[model samples]
Target: MELIQKVLDQPVAVSQPASLRPYNSKLKVHDQILCGKIMHSNFSKLAYSIMQSVGYVHDIRAVLFEYMLL
Candidate 1:
C-alpha cells in the first residue's frame, strides 16, 4: 500500500523529443521502432512485477481504471 501510494503521489515524468537520443546516432527508422517496442515491453514487465508484489495482480485492470479516473 505504501509503495502504491508513493507511486500515485509522484507526478508523471514526461520526456520531450529533444531529450531522447538513439543508441546509434545513425539509427534508421526501423531501428527506432524496434527500440520503442523493446522499451514498452520492459516497462510492462516491470509494472506487472510491482503489482504482483503488492498482491494486486488480480485487480490490475480495476486499479488502473480507477487511477485513470483520478
Candidate 2:
C-alpha cells in the first residue's frame, strides 16, 4: 500500500495494486473512494464491538443500533 496526502491536507493511505492496466482504476491516486468504503465498514464493526463490550441493552438491540447508525 502507498500512503499519499489527499487535497494537501488529509493524508489517506491506499492500497497499491501489483500491476496497472490501461483501463484499471487502481493507478488513479485521486480517488479515495476505496479507502473511504473500507474505513466505513471497519468503523461500523468497531462501533458494534464497543456496544457489545458495554452490554447495557439487549444483544439484538445493540447490533441493530450499530448498523442503523451506519
Give me the candidate number with maximum lDDT. 1
TM-score of each: 0.31, 0.26
Task: Report the lDDT tens digits of candidate 1 across residue range 1-70.
Answer: 7765654444332122422644233332222322344244444444545654567644563444355349
State the C-alpha lDDT per candidate.
0.42, 0.36
Roughly what TM-score does model 2 have, to 2 decimal places? 0.26
Query: Any idea what lDDT model 1 has?
Result: 0.42
RMSD of each: 12.8, 14.4
Clashes per candidate, residues 3 or more apart or on different chains: 0, 0
